[model samples]
Target: MKKNNNKLLGVVATVVMAIVSLIALFPIISIVLSSFIPSGSLMRNGISFSFPWDELTLSNYTYIFTQSAEYWTWYGNSLWISALMIVLSLFFSSMVGYALAMYDFKGSNIFFVAVVFILMVPFEILMLPLFRLMMDMMLIDTYLGVILPGIVAPVAVFFFRQYALGLPKELMDAARIDGSTEYGIFFKIMLPLMGPSLAAMAILQGLGSWNNFLWPLLVLRSNDMFTLPLGLATLLTPYGNNYDVLIAGSVMTIIPIVILFIFFQRYFISGLTVGGVKG
Candidate 1:
């Protein structure tokens, strides 16, 4: 009787989870189906899951590929910025985090506290001063302007620092005894161990950089310099709304992030778990 009850509970739990999964996936499914229909139909209906299958068309994709030149440019700009942010942020933030975690330096605790304090402060509070600094440095309207401020993210630093604390220090001692330079010890012996943290941050920072609009809007002057999110916003104006390009382009924007998450998903969960546990 107990065995039968246990089996029944398991079946019920599976059914409940399946229903929850479908509920979560509803919005994504709706957007994908909406992308197939005409933009006019979409604008009129406001994204319906019950639309007739025959009403679907491929013209939205065709327009984005053929007619939308600016769309490609925006896509490229976003891709470049996101890639640079992930690489540079990981390289510098990891080094700082590892040093804070492993080495007993003067003001190390002070630096960590500062990082936590800065993390608590909102980005909006810093934007005005950062904007002025960018202007003073003559980096406005450039990719450097967009990428510089975010290169050493506080959250990434904190995450890395926390994760690095869990790394075995005996490896560092052994590497030192083997006559490895400090950089060699970190790059060769330590970095490989932080793979999960790196993958996790790459996905997170990539997503943030790709979707960022306000900062880019403040710094970038020319339409050519605009990132994907900024470019997509311009499609809706007082004169007209390019719902066709908007919806299609929006769907395309999800592709890179989805790919990033899929590739790094194995590490992402483990990274977050371990990183959080130490601190």
Candidate 2:
């Protein structure tokens, strides 16, 4: 009787989760379907299944490929900026996290506490000060301006620190006994074992940077330097709302993130699991 009840419970849970997943996916589906509707039709129908399918056209996509030079420019900018931000953030955040977890320094504990505290504070409060600093550094309207602030994310540090705590110290000791330098101990001995955490951070940070709007909006004055999110928002100018372009553009933008998740799907789960486990 217990076995049968357990099987029944499992089936009920699976069906419930499937329903939730469909609900979560409904927005993306709506956006995609809307992208096919003729320009101004979505504004009129407000996204109903009752709209005639035969009237849908591919001109939205056609505009993107052939007539959307600005969109492609924003796409390329996001690609490179996100790619660089991931590299720098992973390197610096992981390095700080590894040090905090492994080494006992005078201020190490204090530093970790500071990181936690900073993580608790919201970014909105820091924007003015950060912008002032950016001005002092003369980084405005540049890729560096968009990316510099995220290079050492506190959340990434905390995640890496927690994950690194779970690594075996014996490997570090063995590397040290082999006359390996500290850099060698970490790079050669530790980095390879950090596959899951690295993959998770890359995906999370890449998505955040890709979807980010406000900071990039503040920093990028030049249209050519604008990231995808900002560029998408630009479509809704006071002069006229470009809903047709926005919907189709948004549908296209999801492709890269989907590809990233597909490529790192295996590591992403394990990474989050391991990184969240206690010291």
Candidate 3:
């Protein structure tokens, strides 16, 4: 009787989860379907599960691909900025985190505490001071201005530090005894061990940088310099809304993030779970 009950419960749980997954995916499915819809229909109806199958057309995708010069430029800016941010952030943040976890140095605790504190503080509070600093340094309206402020993000540093704590310190000693330099040990020995953490952080950092809007909007003056989020917003005016291009472009924007996750998904779960275990 107990065995039969357990099996029944498992079946019920599976059905519940399947329904939940479908519910979560409804919006994504609606958007993809709506991309094939005509601009006039989209403006009139907004997005919905119901589609006029006969009216669905590929013109939206065509318009975005061929005529949207500004769209491509925004896409390119976001791509490079996101890519640079991921590489630079992982490089610097991991090192800082590793040092804090491995070495017993002066003021290390204070630094870690500061990182945690900063992580708790909202970005809005820091934006004013950061803006003033960027202006003084003449980095405003530049890629550097956007990328520099967040290159060593507090959350990344904290995550890496927590993950690094669980790494074996015996390897560091072994590398040092073998006459390896500090940089050599980190690059050759420690970094390889951090693959999962790196992959997880890459996905997270990429998503954050790609979707970022406010800071880019505040700094970037030129239409060409605008990122995808900023550029997409400009499509809506008091006179008109470019729903067709907007929906199609939004679909295209999901592609890179999807690809990033697909490639790293094998590590994503383990990385996030392991980092949290130590903290």
lDDT at residue 120 of model 2 (Cα atoms): 78
Give the TM-score of each candidate.
0.89, 0.89, 0.91
Native RMSD of candidate 3 (Å):
2.2
Compared with the true structure, what per-residue lDDT tens digits does model 1 show for residues 232-256?
Answer: 8998764436877888898899865
Candidate 2 stretches with Cα past 4 Å from truth are 1-17, 237-241, 269-279
Tens-place lDDT per residue, model 3, 1-279, is 999999999999999999999999788888888888788887877765677889889999999889888899999999999999999999998999889888899998788788667777888998899999999999898988999987867667777887788899999999999999999999999989988789878877878888998899888888899999998889876444677678899889986667766777866565445436545
Q: Give lDDT tens digits, candidate 2, residues 8-101.
A: 9999999999999998988888888889977677777777757668877998888888888989899999988988999999999899989989
How would you order the candidates by TM-score, starting with the best?
Answer: 3, 1, 2
Best by the lDDT measure: 1
What clash count goes with each model?
A: 0, 0, 0
What's model 3's overall lDDT? 0.84
Best TM-score among the predictions, by candidate number? 3
